[model samples]
Target: MGSYRWNWPILLADPYYGWIVSGFGNTCLIAVLAWSIAFPLGSAIGIARTTELRPLRLVGTIYVEVFRNIPLLAQMFLWYFVVPELLPQDWGHWVKRDMPYPQFLTSVLCLGLYTASRVAEQVRSGLEAIPRGQHHAGLAMGLTPAQVYRYVRLPVAYRIIIPSLTSDFLGVFKNSSLALTIGVLELTSQARQIEEYTFAAFEAFATATLLYCAVTGIVILAMRQVERRTRIPGTIAIGAQ
Candidate 1:
């Protein structure tokens, strides 16, 4: 411990700092893009799972089960490597050789599809937690099945599941670190690079740990505010009571 030089200033200065900052930005960009894809896709699948249509429900169930059961790292590799090969030969070569930012694009798609499975389960749970009578009432009021879901069901269900969704959102940010495995150079990867260059593993990882905490802390506070604003009165959250 005595010989370990604490050179945070060195780490914070010049090309090193720039690399870490760039990596942080990439992490954020990947997480946001992935969540953008996951949310709507998950919502649709969740709704499908709850619908009376068996075929639609089966499709939704299969999607959620297959994605959720598979490991994320495996999915990432599949998206980056196997998927392009599975495409037509011309397209495969294009993706492998000509596609810009292939790793980044593959990371976004992999993370989005992987996270969508968990989000789908949360959404399905939220929708199903609503009283059965609510559905009947919506129908009785002359609303079409679609309208009942669009205007009546989804809004309430979303409110009920905001807390769970918040967790999923944070999960996206944390999981973005896994992009390092495929050469995205996200924060974790950058930290490793810094350690290699500077021999300051402690400083590198400590800085990363603080940045992660800061980001997730902000998310937690923001989500809490959303929960406060959107929470329904007299209704318990899914796991409570």
Candidate 2:
């Protein structure tokens, strides 16, 4: 323990600090892009699962089952390596050669799709939790099924599931660290590099841990505010009326 010297100064220095900042930026960008893809795709699939159409429901169920069952690391590898090869020769070549930042793009798609499965389940659960009479009431008002979903079901379902979605959003950011394995130099990767060069494993990892906690804390706080504001009167039972 006496041999260990913590150097916070190095993290604040010129080139090393720059690397950390760049990694943080990449992490944020990937998380945001992945969420953008996951939320809409997941919502659509979730809605489809609840619909009367057999084909649509089957499609949604299959997508959720397939993606959720597969390990995310395996999905990342498949997207980065195998998927491109499975494409047409020209497209494969383009993905392998002409595409800029292919690793980043691949990570985004893999993370997005993988997380979408979980999000779909949450959305489905939220929708199902709503009273069945609401659906009938919406239909009784002369609204088309689509209109009922748009106006009534989705809005309330989304409000009910905000907490779960917030957790998923946080998970997406944390999971972005997996991109390091596929050559995207996000924060965890940078932290590894710091340890390699500086041989200060504790310092490197500790800083990374703190950064992760900070980001997650901010998300938790922000989402709590949203949850409070959007909370429905009787959706979540509190002891009293």
Candidate 3:
């Protein structure tokens, strides 16, 4: 029945402070590890989707559609709870009980694969943005399609898409909060834990919010520098502010 009181100092107290730090560390770890998976896998899928072969492209398309359409929280649950049961008995037991950091690994995998679908679309669009003339010229120069992608088309496409990829990269950090659903004890989960114990809901989550903003701010600055360096002449950055 009393007015809510703010206690900002509690955020700096011992275990609570450690929780925030650990949560921040886990958040960063998840985002980076997930991106490691998303970048290459998505890039490969995108490339596959763009190729002349119909079956390969179809497979890539299906992967994108399935992952993209489903909600991420559902994917997290499926990976952590359902996939283990689907595995063989011994392996399933190992995954559910004995695997190292199972929650962390599962969260990383689910988030990575989910983000990969979006990244695949980005990559596909980036590749398609290349002019047909370059593709034809590369072929005329006796370059294999793969070689053309390696030497000419991919280089330009990557440069053209750096800004877009930067957004995708930032998205991983925000999306990673969903890891809390799988008991990953990530940033958002830690914030909730702090609230449960201290009842300082505002302080706990305000700290988490500030931490997220700080991380994203750094990422934006770094990626902007990268985009500036990698920008191709005569091509405007697609989503520059």
> Estimated TM-score per prediction?
0.96, 0.96, 0.96
RMSD to native for every prediction? 2.1, 2.0, 1.8
lDDT of 1 at 184: 96
Better by lDDT, candidate 3 or 2: 3
Q: Where is the poorest 10-residue window by lDDT in model 1?
A: 232-241
Q: Give the backbone clash total of model 2.
A: 0
Tell me which residue pairs clash in candidate 1.
none
Scored by CA lDDT, what does every candidate get? Answer: 0.92, 0.91, 0.92
Question: Which residue pairs collide in model 3, if any?
Answer: none
Instruction: State the lDDT of candidate 2 residue by residue for 208-234, as single tens digits.
Output: 888899999998887777777777876
Kindly report which residue stretches of model 3 are placed more than 4 angstroms away from their true locations once superposed: 238-241
Error of 3 at 142 (Å): 0.9
